[model samples]
Target: MPRTVAPARRHSARSRRLRLTAAFAVLVAVAGYLTVQYVTGGTSSDQCTVESADGSAGDGRTYRMSSEQAANAATISAVGTTRGMPERAVTIALATALQESGLRNIEHGDRDSLGLFQQRPSQGWGTEKQILDPVYSAGQFYEHLAEVPGYSRLPLTVAAQRVQRSGFPQAYAKHEPDAALLAAALTGRTPASLNCEPPRSTAGTGGMTKVRAALVRSFGKDVLPATDGAGAETPAAGAAAGALSVPVDTPLRSGKGGTAQRGWELAHWAVAQSEALGIDEVAYAGKTWESGSGWRTERKESGTTSIRIQLAR
Candidate 1:
C-alpha cells in the first residue's frame, strides 16, 4: 500500500516556512556582497573560516567560503555522486572545472558556451539544454572518461584529456590544487562548516538530499555504474536502523555539541547520502566519518570542539 504523507508534513511545512523566512533574510544581505570562494579550479584570494555545522568556531565569528564557487562545487559533487563516481572522479571534475569554467558557473562564456564547464554546443556538447545543465555535463564527462581504460591510474591530465580533448591541454593542470581543495569540500572530505551564505531566495531550498533525489530522477541512473567506487558508503547507510536514522534527541550545536542521537543522525545522514551527496565522510563532535562509506572513529577529539560537519573524509 502507498504510505500516506506523515502528519509531520504539516509541522514540517510550518517549520520550513519559518526557516525560509530566516534563510531569505540572510540571503538579501549576502546576495550582492562579495562572498568568499568556498573552493574552485582557479587561484582564490579568499581566506577560509572554520565553523561548526551550526555555524561557529572558537570565537562567535561565522565561517565563510565563496557562495558562488560553493554552488558550482556543490553541483559538481552532487552530479558525480548521482553518477556514482568517487573522490578521484571529483578530482578529475575539478580539473575539468579548472579548464572549462573557473567554477563560477556563468550564464555566458567563450562563444555560446555557458556555465562553469564552458561546454559548447557548437562543439557537439548536447544542445544548449544539455550543456547548461551542470549535472548533465559532468555526467557526460564521466561517461566518456570511464570508457578510457586505466583512467584512474593515468596522470590527472592524461585522464582528463581522454575525456575533454581540449586545445589547451596543459591549461587544466593549473587548476589541480584549487580543484583538490574544492574536491575535499565538495566530496565531503573537508568540512560542512566551510559553507557559503544562503543562495538567492529565488533558488528554492530542499537541502542536499532533496536536491539529490531530484537530480537522480532527472538523469538516468546509468550515468554511473554500480561498479564505480562511488558505492563505498552504502554499507554505512545500512548501519543505522531508520532510513533517516537521526534519533529524536539528536544534539543541536550552537558551537557546542548535540546529544548522541543528533550526532548519530548526522553520521547516518552523511553515509546515507554519501554517494548522492558526493560526500566521502562527515565528522561531528568526537565522531569521525569512516565506515568504508560512513564515518569511523580514527581518533576522537576531546573538549569544547563544536559539532563541525567537515568534508575531509
Candidate 2:
C-alpha cells in the first residue's frame, strides 16, 4: 500500500538528521581541541622567564610550560654541561629536545620513540628503560653528537641533524633562540636569570634528602661530597632537617668563568628545582629566590661559598 507523506514532514526529518550530524562534528572538534591543549601544556597558566643578566627592563623572554617541562629542561642542560660539553652543544641538544618532546619526558611518540629526545629502543638508541631516563637519554644524545666532527663549529641544525637524523631536520633551527636562552641561564653563562612561577601553595615532598638525590642525579656524584665517611657532612650534623647547604667546591668554581659563574649555576639550578623539590627558598651569592618573591638582592649577609636551600615544612 502506498501512503503519501506530507513534504514538510519529510523536510523536517531530513533537517533534524543534518542538525544532529552538525552537532556531532562540533563535539568532535571541541574534544580534539581540548586534547591538544592538554598535551601541549596550554591549559597551565604557569610561566617561565629567561633573561640575559644584562638585559634591560622588559627585555626578558617568557614562555608557557608546565613545571615538569622546566625541570626536565634544566636537567638536560645540566647533563650537557656536566659532560664538559660547551654551551653551543647544550643549545643544540636542548633545541633538538624542544622540537622532539617540547622539553617533556614523554613515554610514547611516533613509532615507539620515547623520552625527551624520542630515542627508540628498536633503533638502537637504548632500551625503553634507558631512553625513559632523562639523564641517560641526554647523555646518549651528546655521545652521538660528539662523533660529528667539528660539531661545535657546524650550524646548529646541521650538527643536530647529523646526530638525530630526524625526518624534519630543519625544524631544530626554530627552537634555537629559546634553547640558547635556556642554555645560557641553566649552564651558568647568565646570572640571576631563569625563574619559574609555580602556584603559591604548591610544595613538593621529601625536602633536603630529595634535593641532594636530585643534585646527584643531574650533576653526578662528584657534585656532592663522598658519602662513605669522607669529608661529607651527614644530614644529622649539618643544618636543620628542612635545610640543606650545598658547598660550591673549588673544582666547580675553577671552571672557565671561575667561582662567581659556578656559584650562580648551582644557585639557579636550585631555584629551577624549587617547585619540583618543594624548596621554599634558595639563597646564594648575596641574592635570594624565595617561592613567592622570585630573585632579589639580600640585605642580610649571604656568603657566596654555599647555596642554602630551605625546603617547605
Candidate 3:
C-alpha cells in the first residue's frame, strides 16, 4: 500500500519548488550581471587599453584604464606636445600625475593639493578653480617642467619629482613604464595603440562647434586653423549636419613626428574625448571606432590624411 498526499498538500509542495526555481534564476541573473560589470570595469563604458609596440611596460606590454583616465592622459600628452615638449617630457609628466593622483582630475587631496598633479593652490599652483581644470593643470605642470634644465634627459623620477616635489618622491619611478606606454600611444609615436570604448549615452549636444573648440583648447588654434589653404574657414568634410573633420596633412604644431603620426594623434584624441564631446564615431587611417563597436577596419578604406569625427545627434 502507498500513502497518498492530499491535493492541497501537493499543490503547496509544487509552489515551494516553483519559488525555489525562481529564486535560483534571480541569483543566476545577478551573478551574470556582476561578472559583466567586473569584466568591463564600468556599467556605461568599456576599459581603455594601450599596448606597447616595443614590449615596454614589463612582460604585460599592456596597460588597461577606464576611459576617464585615458581622457586625462590624452589631455596631459596634448598639453606637453603642443608646447614642443618631447615625448620624454610627456612621459615624465604622466608619471608624476600617476603618482600624485592616478591621472584623475580629482578635486580633493591632502590639504590644498588638488587636480591631476595634486597641485596645492596654497603653494601657488593656481586658484582652486584653475587647478581643477585638466587643461590648465596640465599646462601649468609642463610650464614648470620645461624650466627644469635638461629635463628630457633626466631620470623619470628626478624630473617628475623636481616639478611635483611630492612627499613620495620615489613613487613616480614605479609608474614610469606604464607612463611611457601611455606617452608613446598618446603622443602618436605608436599608431593605433590606444583604444577606448565609447560611452553608452551621448554626454551632450554641443556638436561640431564644441568639438572644434575642444581641439583648439587642447592642441592649440593651429589644430583647426581659422583659414584653409584658400584662406577660408576650413569646412566640415562631410555633408551631414554633425560631421567635423580635422586635417592632419602636416603636424598641427611644429614637431618631430610626421603627418601620419599627426593623423593618428588627432584620431586617438577624438576617441579619448568622445564621451566628453558626444562623439558617435571617429574614422582615420582606414580604421573606424563607433560608439558600441570599438575599432574595426573599414571594408572601404578611408583616407589617412584627415581625421573625421561624427557627432552624436
Which candidate ranks first by lDDT, i.e. highest? Answer: 3
The stretch of ten residues in a row with the least summed lDDT in candidate 1 is 242-251
Candidate 3 residue pairs in backbone clash: none
Error of 2 at 241 (Å): 2.8
User: Each candidate: what lDDT?
Assistant: 0.51, 0.78, 0.79
TM-score of each: 0.49, 0.82, 0.79
Write model 2 residue lDDT over 126-147, tens digit each, in one string.
Answer: 9999999999999999999999
RMSD in Å for all candidates? 21.7, 9.1, 16.4
Candidate 3 lDDT score relative to the true structure: 0.79
lDDT against true structure, model 2: 0.78
TM-score of 2: 0.82
Error of 1 at 58 (Å): 14
Clashing residue pairs in candidate 2 are none
Candidate 2 residue runs with Cα over 4 Å from true position: 1-38, 41-43, 228-232, 235-237, 250-255
Worst 10 residues of 3 by lDDT: 36-45
CA displacement after TM-score superposition, residue 149 of candidate 1 (Å):
2.0
